[model samples]
Target: MSANDPGHINDLSKDQEESLKNFWISIIDKITNKNKISLEDFYDSTYGNELFNLFASDNPDVVLLRRLRARKWNVNLALEQLINTLEWRFQWGVNQLVAKGESELSYQEILTGKTFYIGYDRFGRPINYISVKNHIKGQFPSETTEKLTVLSMEIGRKLLHCPVESVTLIFDMTEFSMKNMDYQHTYFLFNLLQNYYPESLGLALIVNAPWIFNRCWYIIKRWLDPVVENKVHFINNIDELTKFIDLSNIPKHLNGNKPDFNYIPPTEQDNIMLSAFQNDFSGNKKARENHQQASINYLRITYQWAQTNHNKDLLEQRKKAMEQLRDAYEQLIPYITTRTHYHRYGLIEEPIFYKTYQRIQQENQQESVHF
Candidate 1:
């Protein structure tokens, strides 16, 4: 980290940079038992498995920041939280869940369109809608619904581009009643987001929350982390949401401009790559190798960046390696995981996906001045 460039990676301040570096060092030390070890070597070891690949696919710096922010920049606590999350994921077989792709959950869950990503907010964060009205207690098995939620989070992660790390969650509570209330399900979700996916939620809007939800919310709020609880807002009307989301992005059922949720089943064409390479073991092996090498390269660069005290040149190299890793992961997706609605419709490729809050704000200001 150059002294002149305090916000070198992801616009982090000097203190924040120091904390992030400390976190990296601490985790590395734990993994290496205080012995010096190169990142490439560790990445090749048994410890650096699929979960490590998952973290690499997600920009590791951003992932670290998410945990740090969740713990208010406390390195030790963030480390604990992250370790717990990794342990949970391993125990819960999250890698297999992701590897199995969209089919792991029942078709009924997909048809209900209970949860899905739509358009993004003004700041380019994807908006994930949870159709509370469609969900009835015990309608689906606990494991199935949990998997659906994890799949949704995994998809949401893909939608996030740089400078837009979180997603807005709208729990559309229109026509909500006592039968729709699932306290256990709600607890699992909030706990998962707060602990495992810290800072992944930008905002949560309880839209059209029925009068019955009041009692339920009182209990639910107690289960949330203070930071997460603060992000939850009750929206009585669509206009109130416009402060964050443009009307064009909101669903029409909520009296906004966009159409309601529609589930598009994955067609054969959607899995064209998988179909093409199904029997070609050599091709799949090569793709996996490419992705693995790219991931290791990223970790190697990141380790150098940290060891060099965040040298400006090493930071740039780290960034380039991160991009290479992301590209590799995308190339490997078709082979490793099945295509979801986001890929089929190219939702994440929309122009809005590339915009940052600063760019959007500048454009909005220019429009206001023109008027």
Candidate 2:
């Protein structure tokens, strides 16, 4: 490829690359009912197609290419994997899953407690820990485990803001018991990560794997595909995990030098507003009203502060303040917009998000250029 060329050199054989490309092209054609690429064409496709569009490196060809690489490019196997994953998404409602949050699920918070974003690895990948024994007990341990695994994966990918990181999942089977182990759920979780969320797993550290873990691992081992197998690491000691994770970033629970998992209450005004929103959403009308007032007051304060303190000397600080103000104002706009959920207090006004998005874009451009 020439220096000016945009695409990267493919590691695949010419025939194989073309085959994958053809597969992608055929699928795109089927989805759009058209041969060509266009804005509307990509948009018309549903979640399955959207995954392709979002993941495509300049084109749809790479979407299948990654899947092919993940599955060793066995055409029949790749096609099966792709179709199965899309089917899973349809059944699971992958998009709507995170949008509703953990409130809908009774076992969510307990499940969430089991998984924590401890810190980042040496290569800057986010390190997430899952205490397998913590929330393994429920009416159906398998279902609970699966939901928590998916939630952890989703939160790691979307909410955590690790721009250049694939999350490292440390399955801490400390103080383990035979009953805590669910081979079916373990296999399903591994398969889910392998198929749908391809290559998001930088590492899988299995620490403190007691003798009982062997029984489950015997079954689980067979289920892991080659890609997943490569990522999996069985650590005898938790301290061994410190090689990837920095000392300070490591939580005290893991026997690291850093502080314990001190729950940092939402310090930002926006975050506080979100807490109030949750309270309001959970049938507390007063909480909703309070959130609205707080948000409005925040916006006004930031605006007045910016207007009065027009000191060119504090350009950077002013920009940060403006960004905060813009965000706070956006939050206020969405508060009283409309009513949606039977449980939640206010309506889901998407326009606030769109407006915030526009402001963010403008702010980004403004920030890029030195004032």
Candidate 3:
């Protein structure tokens, strides 16, 4: 790489850096309506209201950067895509669904264990296991399956940290047959990730894919963008998979050390947080108000950060604001959300369960950044 090439030395190219600044400036102008709109109103509108509150506390810089990179650093296209995503989240009730927790889907849908997250990859990316044989077309509502898929992706998102913004996917095709094929579901997953959550798939392992699946893959590859299709790998055996993920992280069935997936149903006790909130409405109301204030403050700082040119002091302020926003969100979690299997099984911790992978890495004292 040339020393003069900023892209090689920094996270963003000079042109991309400028586009990111302009992107934020444009959104702030549009959302604030020429500085007429209040910061609180701008926060609620763009973040999709209280329904999206639980999942809305995100680092503005990271969020905007992801969209910019997805659109190849084109500000207008990225802005359009961002708007479409927000509109879709509202129209499809995705914000509400995610905020309410994964309970929105039927018990049986989750029990099937067709799709769920497990351990993290060597790169600190969460591993999402998909048992292809476990899926039977027409057995579950298409919409329900879609919801589950989205929920799983959201779970993976929480586990992610800086420099590891993607998830590792393992599609166990041990039995592989035509009966397992669902073009509709496949297309939805492919398109959804490509368009809305672009550059979010680190790797995809199609394990033990039978010969017959090769024919289907030929057709499927045509539907993928070359960049995405290249990230996919056809694993012939355990050895092939071990190359990408540690054996300790892979399941025993796949010739790895980890235990196989087993779903533990959620119980009434899992709603302990919700029950607490209901029992003490007044106290919970105060907590919610504090959270709302923190949110508004974060947005205010973010807006200011966006307008000013980059500087060490401003960046520190933005970081502190993000920490405060996260702290408020953590404190309000138990009063607002329901627990899931991830919580019950101890795979996740309540009241601020994001970034499990990062936590694990810190505990193990692993600081290397895997590529």
RMSD of each: 10.5, 14.4, 8.8
Where does candidate 2 clash, by residue pair? 338-347
Q: How well does model 3 score by local distance difference test?
A: 0.72
Compared with the true structure, all predictions reach lDDT values of: 0.76, 0.54, 0.72
lDDT tens readout by residue for model 2, 139-208:
4556545665676666564322323435688888878887667666666777777788765677888988
Give the distance in Å from residue 122's predicted Cα in candidate 3 to where it truly belongs. Answer: 1.4
TM-score of every candidate: 0.86, 0.61, 0.85
| Residue lDDT tens for model 1, 127-190 | 9999998889999998999999998888898888766778999999989999889999999999
For model 1, the run of ten residues with the poorest summed lDDT: 350-359
Report the poorest 10 consecutive residues by lDDT, candidate 3: 1-10
Off by over 4 Å in 3: 1-10, 34-36, 46-57, 351-371
TM-score of 3: 0.85
- Residue 349 in candidate 2 has what lDDT? 23
In model 3, residue pairs whose N, Cα or C atoms come closer than 3 Å (at least 3 residues apart or on different chains), thus clashing, are none
Candidate 1, residue 114: Cα displacement in angstroms equals: 1.4
Worst 10 residues of 2 by lDDT: 338-347
